[model samples]
Target: MNTGEKDWDKKGWKDVPIAGLITEPGTARRYKTGEWRTHRPVWDPEKCINCLLCWIYCPDSAIQVKDGKVVGIDLEHCKGCGICAHECPSKVRAINMVLESEAEAEDGEKVKEETMREGEEGEKERKEERKGEGGNEK
Candidate 1:
């Protein structure tokens, strides 16, 4: 119903709300559909020119902006359509579509590194516990 500064009452059909009804508002914000995304748009800040072409082309409105500049992707609502990456200008190519697994793999590596560090710390604790009668809790 609230079309954001747009006078949609004079307009017809174009950009109309679902079922042409305005009973409930802000439904999109209530639910995050990005979990369905299989691939995600990754941005390179160094290469980005803040053109906002991606923002214009994105169907889910996942592109986030700040101060009239492109900032990042809102993964919570992104459906991994890759239109942002596809629409990115060829010369700039600031956006890249990467497999979700690959992106998570990079995060997994960081988690592995952190777990290893924690294991080292726990090793010292285990040794101290072994000195007790429990011997590391059986």
Candidate 2:
């Protein structure tokens, strides 16, 4: 049976039988519902202690645990419910709920900061190298 969305649109509700139709259990896995979320949970690995509390509290089973540790979040099935962030027991707060727009901006800021720091460190090292070479000639 072609249960695809295109087929349903062409068939229309009148032609398609609605009653007594039951899809297989867990069929909802085929759909990515995360797109409907307005807020997303951001994980901080440095603050996480592998307590697994988030995994236990997640309603959608979105928290991915592997080898007795949380590997990452399965965003495709996640509804951005923020349960994982709320359940994180770390004092540093391993998980945080941020607005999607703000999250992007935060990521950009972090990248820029890291780039600037690296550039400064590289410039200092170059200056030191030049000083060392000039001093050797004296």
User: Against the unseen true structure, what C-alpha lDDT does each candidate score?
Assistant: 0.69, 0.67
Which tens-of-lDDT digit does each residue in 1-138 have in candidate 1?
Answer: 224463444546655556656555434353446667789788898999998999899987677676778766776667899998998999999999889878878767784465446445544543464444321110
RMSD of 1: 20.8
Please give each candidate's TM-score. 0.59, 0.58
Q: How many residue pairs clash (N, CA or C atoms closer than 3 angstroms) in each of the candidate models, in the order given?
A: 0, 0
Query: For candidate 1, what is the total of clashing residue pairs?
Result: 0
CA shift at 119, candidate 1, in angstroms? Answer: 31
Indicate the worst ten consecutive residues by lDDT in candidate 1.
129-138
Worst 10 residues of 2 by lDDT: 129-138
Model 1 stretches with alpha carbons more than 4 Å out: 1-25, 109-138
Q: C-alpha displacement of 86 in model 2, angstroms? A: 1.2
lDDT of 2 by residue, 37-120 (tens): 678888888888999999999997777665789866765556789988888885868998888667657777785465456444
Give model 1's TM-score versus the native structure.
0.59
